[model samples]
Structures are given as C-alpha cells and as structure tokens.
Target: MDPVVHFELPCNDRERIARFFEQAFGWEVQMLGPEMGNYVVVTTAEPSAPPPAPPHAVPGCINGGFFTKTPDMPAQFPGIVIAVQDIRASMKKVTAAGGQVLGEPMMIPTVGDYVAFLDTEGNRSSMLQPLMPQQ
Candidate 1:
C-alpha cells in the first residue's frame, strides 16, 4: 500500500501562521516565494542525526505545508499526501476506486509531481510521485 507521506492545510496570512506554529509547536517553517505559489512548509521534526536515513526523511515522521486558499477550490480543508511509485497509474487507480482526480500533476522543482483529488467520500487529498533519485 502507498504510504501517507505528507500533510497540508490552507493559510491566510503566511507570516502570522508561521509564527504561531514555530512558537506553539517549535516547528520550523519555510515560507516560499510567489514563484512557488507562496507555499508555507512546516517541518515538525528534522531527520535524525545519529542514524542514516538514505533518501527517506526522519523515520515515521511526516512534514507538511500550507497553501493559499481560494474559493474556487472545494473542500479547502486539511489534506494528506500519499506517496506513489507511479502517479499516472495511481490516478487511474483512484478513478477506478471512485475517486476524482482534480487536475494534471504539476512538478515542484527539485521535489516531485503532485496532484490533488477527491476520495470516494469527497474528502480532498493529494498524491506525490517524488522525483527519481539522481545518480
């Protein structure tokens, strides 16, 4: 089964939200520029220093981000991102399983291909096919 690798939510004031999370939970926040859609990345826990993690992040730890909410997007509620090996196949699988793929997958520079979708229950979620490891 594909694992849930990330979480996401909507934010209004990026700076205000960043301060709240940093002070409250001690989470590190990275506010992206407008070129990156002004996304706010929240890193709850960094990768462990003692043990090696390879390409994976801190074991059992998932990082998430915040997106600017827009009225056109339905169910702007919190969502999770599932890691997949093949997004096109996964999209087809989601359709076969009664989920609706929202739009075409967009690549996040140095990140991966991402797309949102609606589950069978109409809940918003996302899928990510992380970039292939470079040699």
Candidate 2:
C-alpha cells in the first residue's frame, strides 16, 4: 500500500501560518526561498529518526509543510502526499480509478518529481516520485 509520507497546508500568508503552527503546536517551520516556491517545511518530529517498521507500527509524528495559495490551483486545501515507486504508473492508475490527475509532474531539486490530483470525492492529494541516489 502507498502510505501518506507527507502533507501540505495552503495559506495566504506563509509567515503567519508558520508562526501559528509554531506557537500552537511548537512545530519547527523552515521557510524556503523563491527558487523553492517559498514553501514552508514543518518538522513535527526528529528528522534523523527512521519511521517505525510496519505491521507492528502505527504512524506517528509525520512532518508536513505549508504552501503559498495560488488562485489557479484546484482543491487548494490541506492535502496529503503519497510516495510512489513509479510516477507514470501511479498517474495512470489514478485516472483508471476515477481520480483526476491535475497536471504534469514537476522536479523538486534534491527531492523528487511531484504532482497533485483530485480524488473521486474531490479531495486533493499529492504524489511524489523520489529521486534515486546516484551511485
């Protein structure tokens, strides 16, 4: 199963949203620069710790981010991102399963190729095809 590995919260004011989360939940928010779309990364737990093994493990302390709201984007609400092994195959599956794939995937430097989609219920979600490490 594809697990939700990340999340995103859209906000009109990036700094304000970051401050609110920091004050309310004590989450660490790092605002990225223009080259990175000014996205804010919220760290809810220790980044160095590995996720617990499955079957015996329940998800806990997953980190997320806040993105600047854009008028042109559809389903601009809080969304979860699922990590996929193959983006092209996943995109095909999304359409076959009655989900609407929003747009072409874009490369995120040192991160992955990412894209968003709207599920059958109209809820927006994202998927990431992580960049493989170079040998």
Candidate 3:
C-alpha cells in the first residue's frame, strides 16, 4: 500500500503559522524564501532529514510542510500526501474509485511531482511521485 509520507497545511501568514506549530506542537519549522513560495517545512520528530531507509520504509513518523494560501488552489485545508510510484496510474485509480483528481501535477524543485484530490467522502488529500535517485 502507498503509505502517507508527508502532509501539507495551508496558511495565510507563513510566519504566524510556523510560529503556531513551533510553540504549540514543538515542531521545527523552516521557512523557505519567496522562490519556493514561502513554504514552511515542519519537522515533528528527531533526525529532521528524510529516513535513510528506502522510500516508505520508515514507520509511525512522517514530516510535512505548510504552504502559503493561493487563490487558485482548491481544498486549501490541511491534507496528507501519500507517496506513489506512478502519478498517472494513481490519478486514474482515484477517478475510478469515485474521487476527483485536482489539476495537473506540479513539479516541486528538488522534490517531485504532486497533485491533490477529493475522496468520495469529500476529504481532500494529495499524492507525490518522488524524484528518482541519480546514478
């Protein structure tokens, strides 16, 4: 099964949101600059880096980020990101299962392709196709 590998929270004020999570949950938030859309990386556990094990090998813990709200985006609430092997295949499955896939997948520099969707129950979530390692 594709495990939930990451999460995202929308925020109108990046600094305020980062501060809230930092103080309330003791999460470490790193604010990326404007080039990266002012995204805030939230680390809830130790070893703030991605697990050294193979993708999806880590259990029980996942890291996430907060994104600045954009008017063009839909379902801007808190959402979890599930890592998948093939984005196109996953999108097809989502639609066949009565879910609505959002817009086209977007590429995150140094990350991978990502897209959001709405499940049959109306919960919004997202998927990520991680970048492959260089040879």
lDDT of each: 0.87, 0.85, 0.86
Error of 2 at 91 (Å): 0.2
Per-residue lDDT tens digits of candidate 3, residues 1-135? 998988888889988988888889998888899988888887776653455543334468888999988998778898999999999999999999999999999998767999999999888999999998665
- By TM-score, the best candidate is 1
In candidate 1, what are the lDDT values of residues 1-135, reduced to their tens digit?
999888998887778888988999999988899999899988888777543432347788888998888778778889999999999999999999999999999999877999999999999999999987656
Best by lDDT: 1
Comparing 1 and 3 on TM-score, the stronger one:
1
Misplaced by over 4 Å in model 2 are: 48-59, 133-135
User: Which residues of candidate 1, in runs, are more than 4 Å off?
Assistant: 49-56
**Sort by lDDT, top down from the best:** 1, 3, 2
| Runs off by more than 4 Å, candidate 3 | 48-58
What TM-score does prediction 3 earn?
0.85
Alpha-carbon shift of residue 20 in model 1 (angstroms): 1.0
